[model samples]
Target chain A: MPSFFTGFELAARLNAETRRRVAALARPPRCVALLDAANAGMAAYARRQQAFAGEAGIVLAPEPYPANPEAVMRRLAELAGDEEVDAVVTLYPLPAGVGALEAALALGAGKDVDGLHPENAGALALGAPARPPATAKACRLIAEELAGPLKGKEIVLVGASRIVGRPLASLLLDAEATVTITHAATRDLAAHTREADIVITAAGVPGLIGAGHLRDGATVLDVSINRGPHGLVGDVDVASLEGRSVTVTHVPDGVGPVTTACLLANIAEAAAGRAL
Target chain B: MPSFFTGFELAARLNAETRRRVAALARPPRCVALLDAANAGMAAYARRQQAFAGEAGIVLAPEPYPANPEAVMRRLAELAGDEEVDAVVTLYPLPAGVGALEAALALGAGKDVDGLHPENAGALALGAPARPPATAKACRLIAEELAGPLKGKEIVLVGASRIVGRPLASLLLDAEATVTITHAATRDLAAHTREADIVITAAGVPGLIGAGHLRDGATVLDVSINRGPHGLVGDVDVASLEGRSVTVTHVPDGVGPVTTACLLANIAEAAAGRAL
Candidate 1:
């Protein structure tokens, strides 16, 4: 049977370290704020950031998101000007008509803890210093945790969303790994997946990746969090990899926990005025 | 024998359209400015822009090259404030102390004809509307001119520079092609290249790609302009693809001319306050 790459365990370790780092900082308090636009789905995500912020000994400042784009931009501008705030993460699924690009740019790059701003994304695209999207960061950490060193490794990443595959490609490329990015238009998903030393899926399609798609013992990180009939599931059909020697993360416990941990670590870094 | 996908052909094709478009616009004359840093290579490049701007009925405003980053930023700010200038194209190889990112950001997205700004780059990354990087835009046009459509095709890009590979990846991805980005650290460049239906090399290493690295009928675009003993050459040894049925562009006439044309086209679009 494939050994589960214990995400919760690793997150716990990182979370404790984050707590220590935040504790050492001289302060009345360091703050990490979350801005949401009344989207219930985003509320769940905000809760996750809140939990991580608590672990890192940072204040979780939640903003009352307005309905209009201009109002939201005003709120973001105010937050950008706030000297007390160290980082700001916007909850997704914003009240429609407001794009992430505008929201991210408005948040200002340095306070953009989630790395949504183009400055950060552009920096990551060129393999420079900036906080990477947490899920993408978690995927890298999971691969390093399992594969040891990624240099020269062949990686097939399904989905090219800026939050995940696109940014992750730059990170992996910078780490000296050869990366192939596939998406809805990919002709033969399995053909590319089978050729990789590692396969990461963020397609948001239930049961998109399985045993046949991966080489024997390849590490897999699933970033798509979809609500399925069986409850919250990932892009991979984790059950289908059964009895193989593959190194994989358990569905719910895998990428999610690590992503939260990475966010907290990013907040800690941004507050310290240096990258961790 | 492979057909040479003519760069001058597409550029002339694009340039005529740009002329007609700019002529159609009612204007006291929109101006396009160039900011140079006194680099010899960039001087050659700036002259090309000057010629293009002159042809388009746009003024080629040249900022006196300065030796310092602060001076460049100051000039860029002045250009940004200019009411007459519709676009700004910074000459390449800016003084050593300045990075392209800061200069680009200072140029401001609306006036950045080269598409170097993070806003434009980020919009491109997400496949949203923004000025596409000119070299990347030319690469796409060349491919589309030959291949017709890119959907479901496998593309191997051999450089990840902001000017080429990175932007090209987003463009191809948005067009529904699978893209694999490789670089100097990529373990087996030929393995990836051999599997691709299209190969675009921007890696500056002269003769980095050869016939053996490509599929028999694959399309190749060499973006690297290396000055060799043979004068100027591209990343690929185009002579090696002699007998194949490949569709390709010539070294000097391949991607360079189209890049210049695309910049003019972008200027027209930005002047019109739209993305073409």
Candidate 2:
């Protein structure tokens, strides 16, 4: 069994680092507004905001907007117009209609830290100078920590969502790693997983990856946060891989906190006018 | 030895179908301009245009822009703004860059027949009403033609380019087929292909799939178009699959023409504003 760090721990360390970095730069406090119209829980976001506020001038406003992203974008554009906001972080899942993400990306690229903007997404995809999506950057960070230097490694991602899978794949590919993306409809999912030296599962399916699905000594990064009677379960079955040469990052301590911290880092970058 | 079709034959049939479809609908001549900036081969574009012109009032304009997609997008937007233009089409190769594809997609979803628009791409990924990419659709059509109804069948797609691989996987998933998408980086490409009831290879690697890669009675669709001394070579080594329980599509005739027709169909759909 390997040591596990919860999302809280990751977020804490990230916030600490962000504070130190922001303080060193002698910059003004950053304001981050999370549009929670998609019904993303506010508790986690609040917790992240408080952590940031303790160290720097941080405002975490989770404004609920209409489900229609077009309308939301219009309102967001208006809100952004009024405030001298440093950065806008959106926590909602991909919107229902087309261009929702595109609209978010269009929130004046300089103010967008979420990296879901098409320009940023395209930049990341092309390995150009652009801030990578926070969740994807977090996933890559986890992979880097678990497995040093991913170049030429056979990394298989089990999900291809725009936020996680596709963007992550692009990031990994840019890093010189040979990446394969699998989805729910993928045939012989186990076959692909078993061959991967590193497996990143973000398909949101609990117990999708088990010892049976992976080869011995394979590093597994589970990104799913499925709640069960026991507790939060990941895409990988951590309990079953206790004796295997597998390193499991527990759900709560794995990607969540790191992702939040990365979000803040993105905000800081946007505030600093970092190109990527 | 398995037979292969020349590019000329494929283009001829494709033009005839385009003309017939346009005539049936009593519509104006549809113009499809191939942006060959990536390859800069106007002679090839001219030949393709000639095929279409013989059937309908087609115009072939060769305007080379920087490979960077923003410039290409502006050009596409300019073309889409024309009153005489009904739809727009662009040919893509490995070097054309995703930016070009993205630009083609951004040419107003109403005029995007290739279904490469992010909105349409997302819809295809979600198994919605939007048409799949033309190449992927052609691959599916060929697979079904060779081996009726792919439901419950095992299919393996080599090469996961957004144009062919990713969308093809989505189409197969919609058909209730078990699909696996592998790339050059895949650890055991042959192992997966050998087990598949249908092996569709799109990797430009000439003869990457041969008799050894196919299981007995497996249907093979070679989507690669590699010109060589013996003429065009597909991803699959058609000559080696001679007595095996296999049915392989020729490089020139098989999926190429179907893909062209599918693109024309997508253009028609775009002009008609089917999804709008």
Candidate 3:
């Protein structure tokens, strides 16, 4: 049977470290989360974030913004300038017409805990000092933990979204890993995955990858969480790889929890930067 | 015999279009070129830039800044705010300790002709409207001219530098191509290149790739210009692939002129944006 890499232990360890960092600060870091509570994805993430923020000793202030992009920008700018707020993050599933870029621009670069700001993204690509998006950071940490140092490893990344795939590829490249990024337009997905030492997927399509994409003993880090007919599902079809020699991380208890912990850690770090 | 994809024709076509664009505008765009003029690489680029700027109908104002990072930043900020300067670019090899990030940060995003500014880099990565680095743009245009429509094509990029390889990989990804980035840490470079439909190299090492790293009918876009025992050499050894049924771009006239043309084109675009 393939070994499963669960996130519970890692998340706990990270949360503990985050808690310690927050406590060391002169005052509790005030993290203002600007999100629309109406969006299903953002709502779910908010719930997890609130819970995690409490455990990490961060002052979580959830500010509900209107659907208007301008209003979102105004709120972000206000929060960015507010002396009381140490860090800020805007969750995904923003209003239909609103872009994360706009929000990232309005939120100050130093306080952008999610690292959605273009400056942060640019820094990551340029190999400068910057905090990467939490989801990408979580995947990198998980990959490093599972496969030791990523240097010289052949990693096949199945997605090309700016938030996850693009930035994560930059991080992996910084670690000196040989990275191949394949997307929906890729001619043959399996042709790329079959040769990978590790396959990281953020395609957001449940059951998109199966045993056909795996090579024996390869480690798979599934970063997608899609709502399927059978509840939540990951990009990988775990059942197909059952009893295989590969090791994999499942949907709910894998990248998700680790991502939350990483965000909290980022908030703590942002707070520390502000403290300095 | 293999075919050669020279940059002269494409460069002339692009330069003519740039000339037309600049002529249509009410005023000639003033471009500020900041460099030491002492570094050999910067000197060569500056000379070409001055000649191209004249051809493109742009006012090229070369400015020299001190070695201190702060001085570079101050000059960039002044030029960014200068109404007369429509575009700004800082050549590579900025004094030994001066990093590009600082210069990029100080240079306003809209006027960054080279697209070195973090905001522009972020915009390119996010699929937003922004100019990419001129060299990356040149490579993409050359690849597209040789191989129609990059969608679903297998491309192997042989460098990981922030200026060329990383941004070029992002540009290729945006074009919907499957990109494999192999750097100095890659175990077997040939293993990745042999299966590629197109191989774009920016690795500075001369003769790093040859016929052994290619498949029949592969299109190779050599983006490196190394000063070797022979006057100037590219990453690919042309003699090694002399009789192969492949397409290659030679040094001196391969990617160099096209890159200069692209930079002039970008200056036009930036000037046009500022005119609005």
Candidate 4:
């Protein structure tokens, strides 16, 4: 069988390479704010961000906000306007009144490291020269690390959320990869997944991917984090994937840590202005 | 198996009822612009707009702009700035420079009845109340018309393009339906298709959905139009789908017509400032 973890490992390696490249460029240190909701799984994010801080400077401000996005946006806008902040990073499940996260980011576009702003996301989608979303950039880094080059590779994304699936697919397509995105309503999702040289899943459904659903030796990145008896289970069935040339980010260790690191990098880029 | 199309039709009827209730209030008609790409497809769109004009006093302005959206945006902005023009609708295959259609739409948000603008699209994705993209609205309308009430129906969308698949899924999800969006990279796509109550294909691949891929009574909507030897073909195999529980919008008569009509409606809403 071909290597299943090939893509994941490649992504890791590419992430490292990007860091090395950035280091060579003498980029400045950065910080990120991790917004936590009362319902958000913060413990795991804490551990993950700590590891990320070890790699680069990242601050976790676990301020819980109401689901009202307007309130959140007001807070975020205040944060963006602050002199101490370099860039802003947020976890989903935002409180009410904070719905304009993207618009808020636009207010601090240069200082927005996560690339969640509609402007950045839209720019990324159009393949324009713009700051790539941190998570999406990280996802691309992973793809580049596992695969020798992403050009012409068929990549299948198993979610279409703006933060991950849609932006990531746009990034991959911009990289010249044949990209496809599948969501809850997709018909024959497995068929599309089977054809991918790489698969990225962030659907938040634990064990949604199993051996039966994959092609031989396909790289799977389980971006979903399901907290239950298994602690942190990714979208993929890691146990069943044994001996299948698979390499996974072990939900606790994989994308979570990398995502924070990428956030810091994004902040650094925003502060630098030359990052785009 | 169970009849998916019938269920879809039932849901559509319910939606129609809801729409009827909403329409009972005397409100100004919405305006939607159909941005013509100067391609052959424009003629068909114009004819469809004529019929819509008769029904709701909707004004259809088919403006041909270069596929490049930057130039198109300049034109769109000029038109949108006009008091007579309520909403600016530009057809797809946007001119190269039209980098972010969403951004351009954002320029005319209050008037953007189709809701394809990035902010509007994002708002829809977040499940906030906003105008939806015309294609998505048409898809929802078709699904609702075919299905009685969309709640809890298994809908599979083939293709994950932002214009159609992603936004369509968001609309369907808001209507309390289960939606899955699949694209070229999905694995065992047929298995998913066979299980769906409704299938909407926008992959732009001609005849990608065939008889073998569908359930006995699945309702199919082909959102893709392929200029083939037969003139125009949809993503679904229409010939094979005939007489089954499947009711497809033929490439020429199906979604194409509805989308144009919806665009006009969007324009009217934009002009009246009632779409927000």
Query: Worst ten-residue run, lDDT, model 3 chain A?
Result: A89-98
Task: Give the runs in model 2 whose Cα sits over 4 Å from its true position.
Answer: A2-41, A49-58, A64-74, A80-83, A86-132, A160-162, A176-188, A269-276, B1-45, B53-81, B87-133, B144-155, B160-162, B166-181, B273-276
Which digits, one per residue and each the tens of the lDDT, describe model 2 over residues B90-191?
655423454654565457656666665555664554334676778888888778777898876888788767677766866776676766666766667787
Over all chains combined, what TM-score does candidate 3 have? 0.95
Name the TM-score of chain A in model 1.
0.92
Off by over 4 Å in 4: A1-75, A91-110, A121-137, A147-162, A165-218, A224-245, A274-276, B1-44, B61-74, B91-107, B114-116, B147-160, B169-197, B203-213, B225-245, B272-276
For candidate 2, list the clashing residue pairs, or say none: A5-A253, A6-A253, A7-A252, A7-A253, A7-A257, A105-A117, A130-A276, A131-A276
Clashing pairs in 3: none
Each candidate: fraction of true contacts kept?
0.59, 0.06, 0.73, 0.06
TM-score of each: 0.89, 0.76, 0.95, 0.71
> What lDDT does each candidate get?
0.79, 0.68, 0.87, 0.63
User: What TM-scores result for chain A when each predicted structure is judged separately against the true chain A?
Assistant: 0.92, 0.85, 0.95, 0.80
Q: Give the Cα error of residue B78 in candidate 3, in Å.
A: 3.8
lDDT (10s digit) by residue, model 1, range A9-128: 889888898888878777523554545645566766676767667766877766657767788788888878877877777666665677887877787888887768877776676455
Against the correct fold, how does model 4 do in TM-score? 0.71
lDDT of 1 by residue, B1-276 (tens): 777766877888898988888887666235544456355676666666787778766667666566677887887788788777788776665666887878877878888877677767766765567788899999988888878799999999997676788888888887889999998878889988999899999998888888889888899898888999979888888788788888777777788889888888888887777322
State how far residue B114 of model 2 sits from its true place (Å).
5.5
Model 1 misplaced regions, further than 4 Å? A24-49, A61-86, A126-128, A269-276, B24-42, B61-64, B68-70, B273-276
DockQ (CA atoms), all models: 0.51, 0.14, 0.74, 0.12
- Per-prediction TM-score, chain B alone: 0.92, 0.82, 0.95, 0.78
